[model samples]
Target: MTRVLRLAVSLALLLLAWEGLVLMTGVPHFILPAPHRIAAAFAARFDLLAAHAVITATEILLGLVLGVSAGGLLALTLTASRRVRGWLLPLVIASQAIPVFAIAPLLVLWLGYGLASKVAMAALIIFFPVTVALFEGLRRTDTGWIDLARTMTAGGNAAGWRVMLYLRLPAALPAFGAGLRVAAAVTPIGAVIGEWVGSSGGLGYLMLHANARMQVDLMFAALLVLAVMALALYLAVDRLLNRVLPWAADTTIPATSR
Candidate 1:
């Protein structure tokens, strides 16, 4: 609750600062609209923005579901074999090295301006962190447990299912949570990037349309919506983690651990 208050205060201050800057700068509304002006834009153009927002939200939700599932399955495979982990790890890392900006256009070209392209872009961004996080957790599985199982003449599958899956994976929740947080943050950016390249709708496309007509207030309003969505996603993920990993529910996370 204290942390929630802190976040609320910080966000309030951020908006205050943003509005103050615009007021002090004496910039034209077309160039840099104040928050009140942005509010007006949101009120006036809400229907349109809401429709686009729904589209983006759908794409983001589908992409996250698909990406996390794929990553988790791949991580399980990586857990089963060092040879596969060694071969695939570099490829995963190398994929991240290529800027999304460079790949987004190709996705647009190949998949065209549709929900598929948007979902693909978001999934591509989300998959790597989850895969890497899970792989790392798998590698760091409890060695003592593995040894004990071996001593008892336990089979590989039984030991893994009994001990590794239940125990080590739970231990790795904090790390996996870190990656999930990253994925949550990146989803909006990835979705927006894809929309910027080709989509007819979404906040990114709306911003483009508004900017072309010198409707800075509308652009600002769209941006605020994007920020809010990202914040909501992060919070939802945090809450889900705490619920699913109840042992971690009472623990205070270190700031740097995120």
Candidate 2:
């Protein structure tokens, strides 16, 4: 498709510029390898990188599920009762204020240097956006729908459930999608930060190891793999959103979405 071609062209141009800059500056490969050298390094270490990729991806998946579930349930409680939101929502907001890096060591201290810490970091980064988006979605139900529910013997709890489940949820799908995109982008960063602080396996650990040993080629390759992994996760989330919310799949977003 034309869109795919354009993206390919854009990437090619970016790579070309990178290659040209390195050549013109006479930069050492150890300091900053050209694209070709980075590619060669990646190919040579493909198996090792693949293994680390699997670990990082697993952490992201498990964390995403945990964060979505907890955050969604919390948001539902807030929407169901004003008292709950008044008392409970501040804690949720406060949690995000704690720097993820600051908590990295604490997570390691509590969860050890395994997948647990990385998953915790990812969940922390992801939970707030999902909660906020779902909350807004529940609040955005149409007044006409509420009136019609009253007329149809679906008042009170029935009305709320019908709107929340059928209309508000579908309308909120796009925000949830947007929030997912933000969460996915941050997930890898969280995982890597965890690895930097304590983990034994993962691209982040591999990068630090390579750097400490002066294996610049291997480090560059790992860095490239990390970038690719983040992009891949983002794309996967986008595809899922489009698949589940086909109404949002169209090229032009409606004004009501604002």
Candidate 3:
């Protein structure tokens, strides 16, 4: 409750500042709509905004599921096979070198201006951090635990699998949780960018259309809704991670003590 109050207070202060800036600067409404103008726009176009919000949210959720699954599977594969890791790790690293914005249009072209393209964009954005964090965690699992797993299992390739599944995966859950939090925060970027590149419906599409028409208040409303959605997604992910990996929550230490 206290945290919620603090957040609300901060947001209120920001809106107050924004409105004050507009009033003090005597800016045109088309150039910078005040908070009340945005609120009025939001109230007037609530239904339209709601529909686009649903489409964007669906894209983000689907992309998150696909991205996490692909990332986890690839991390497992890399951990299980050194040869595969040697061949694929460089490719994975190289993929990130190209800007995601550069690929949005290509994705829209290939996947069409549909949900698929937006989901793919979101998945692409989410894939790297998850893969890297989990893979690193798996690789850095304590040798002592592996030795223990080895002693408990029959001596064979099966024993290594056992060690990986039983020891390393559990140890790496915190890292996976961290990756998930990051993915959640950025998932909207991919979907929105894809929509901006080409889309029939979405908050990004609405914003773009509003901007072109000089409906600044409507654009600001869409922007505010998108920001709220992103924040909610991130907070939901954080709460889930806390539930699933409670140990991580209590692991933080004071900086002064350190």
Please give, for residues 40-117, the per-residue lDDT of candidate 1 as tens digits.
999999998898888888888888888888888888788877898899877878878898789899999999898989
Residue 183 Cα positional deviation in candidate 3, in Å, after optimal superposition: 0.3
Model 2, 22-57: lDDT tens per residue?
Answer: 999998888888899888888988999999988988
* Model 3 stretches with alpha carbons more than 4 Å out: 154-158, 250-258
User: Per-residue CA lDDT of candidate 3, range 1-258, in tens?
Assistant: 999899999989999999999999999999999999999999999999999999999999999999999998999999999999999999999998999999999999999999999999999999999998899988877676676776777565565666777789988888888899999998999899999999999999999999999999999999999999999999999998888888776535532442
Please report, in order, the local distance difference test score of every candidate based on alpha carbons: 0.83, 0.83, 0.91
All candidates: TM-score = 0.87, 0.89, 0.93
Ten residues in sequence with the least summed lDDT for candidate 1: 249-258
Error of 3 at 212 (Å): 0.5
Q: How far is each candidate from the true structure, as Cα RMSD in Å?
A: 3.8, 2.7, 2.8
lDDT of 2: 0.83
- The reply for model 2, stretches above 4 Å from the true place, is 154-159, 249-258
**Best prediction by TM-score:** 3
Tell me model 1's lDDT, rounded to 2 decimals. Answer: 0.83
